[model samples]
Target: MPSLRIMPKVMTLTDAAAARVSALIAQKPGVKALKIGVKKGGCAGMEYTMTWAEEIGKFDEIIEEKGAVVLIDPAAMMYLLGTEMDYKTDKLSSQFVFNNPNQKSACGCGESVNLEPATPPGFAPAEA
Candidate 1:
């Protein structure tokens, strides 16, 4: 039988991240998920953007896990493949951090990152 789907593994989150997301969603009105994308800015050329997703877009990739929902922007999919999100809360700071395989470098403050497209298995370098 021919397969009809190619499910792309978007990303995952740590327990702390999931817990924080679930709590934040409870405070918002009619928000269904957290939408994640990348925008050009900061010292490293790109920064991650987060917004409340009231509704999923047609091309958005949805990932539901750990009691929370995350929507990946279509354009950011290629750069976010095989990534994991973690939340850290210390006496001085609290933030969500991305452990991305496609990231090439990050700024000193960690607010921005330089990203590269994730290459698929068996991909030829010559094609790039």
Candidate 2:
């Protein structure tokens, strides 16, 4: 059975971001979704990770918004709660940006983020 945890608190997405994700997914016929997570490696201890999902695994947390599917791993949910996914475009750069509430700080280059521990009323961190 699929895990039935409460729905995640997703951040707001700009119209451009929604459109960009839709277009990108359309370009890859074999990709059915996008996976979002964090990995330990960046200067600030954590880095955002995203990939195309060919299929939704049994343990994945599926969050759908604006016709896009965001697949998140259960282990990464604590660091990503209340995070917003946005698209930004400027004369020199363009990319998908993550605005995460649990972030304590980020590296100077903005490539790494340090996540604060989750403190929801009834939630606790899993033992390591």
Candidate 3:
């Protein structure tokens, strides 16, 4: 069997977040993994998408950390670079949070995010 390896990138998850994800998976039967990605069509131009995965597709980018599997859509990798996943709990509510460094801004409701395009390899912007 081929070893599963994650590419060295800026994306990461907090220990607390990882533990919460593990607990979620354990509580839900038949959930093989978790999928995280970005999608178009949101107030801030981009939105995060997450779903429970029963099976992993061939093109899915599997990132395993702290005993949890995070499946990333191949195409969404670029836009999700430098992202961090965190779990939050408060008096009124608790939820998974995303700290994305590429983000330029977010809407008032916090339901959407806008990100800067990924820089190409070895490419630099010209000075104005």
Candidate 4:
């Protein structure tokens, strides 16, 4: 029998991110997960969007780790592949950070980023 190939996850979370996610969802009763996506309104051409999800979407890519459940919007998958979600805290502030391999650049204010779609391993672009 031929072996089936396993696919890589679109995203993963760090321990800090998972703990923070677990804490955030604990505040709201019946919250299902955290949803993440990208939007096209920032100066750098894209912005990450996050929302508390009460329900999962049909095509969402789900990543659960250390009791934290995150739903990645299907539309954002290509841009999010090989990305790692992290939570960082300093004296000034705390925030969730995305370490994405597909990111090309970021805006001055750190509110937006320019991203390119990730090309999966062994994938070849169709000749145009």
Whole-model lDDT per candidate: 0.91, 0.82, 0.82, 0.95
lDDT of 4 at 78: 94
lDDT of 2 by residue, 63-122 (tens): 777887778876788788788889899999999998788999999999999997576667
Candidate 4 has a TM-score of: 0.94
1-128 in candidate 1: lDDT tens per residue? 99796656979988899999999998999999999999999999999999999999999999888998899999999889999988998999999889999999999988999998787776654454
C-alpha RMSD values across all candidates: 1.7, 3.4, 4.4, 1.5
lDDT of 4 at 12: 92
Per-residue CA lDDT of model 4 for 56-114, tens digit only, reads: 99999999998999999999999999999999999999999999999999999999999
TM-scores for all candidates: the values are 0.92, 0.85, 0.84, 0.94
lDDT of 2: 0.82
Q: State in Å the error of residue 78, model 1.
A: 0.7
Worst 10 residues of 1 by lDDT: 119-128
Local accuracy of candidate 3 as per-residue lDDT tens digits, 4-115: 9655464578998889888889998999888998888678898889999999989987878897778888778877777889999999989889887778999998888997
Instruction: Give the lowest summed-lDDT range of ten residues in model 2.
Output: 7-16
TM-score of 3: 0.84
Best by TM-score: 4
Clashing residue pairs, backbone N/CA/C < 3 A, model 1: none
- Predictions ranked by TM-score, top down? 4, 1, 2, 3
Q: Where is model 4 more than 4 Å wrong at Cα? A: 1-3, 126-128
Q: What C-alpha lDDT, on a 0 to 100 scale, does residue 103 get in candidate 2?
A: 95
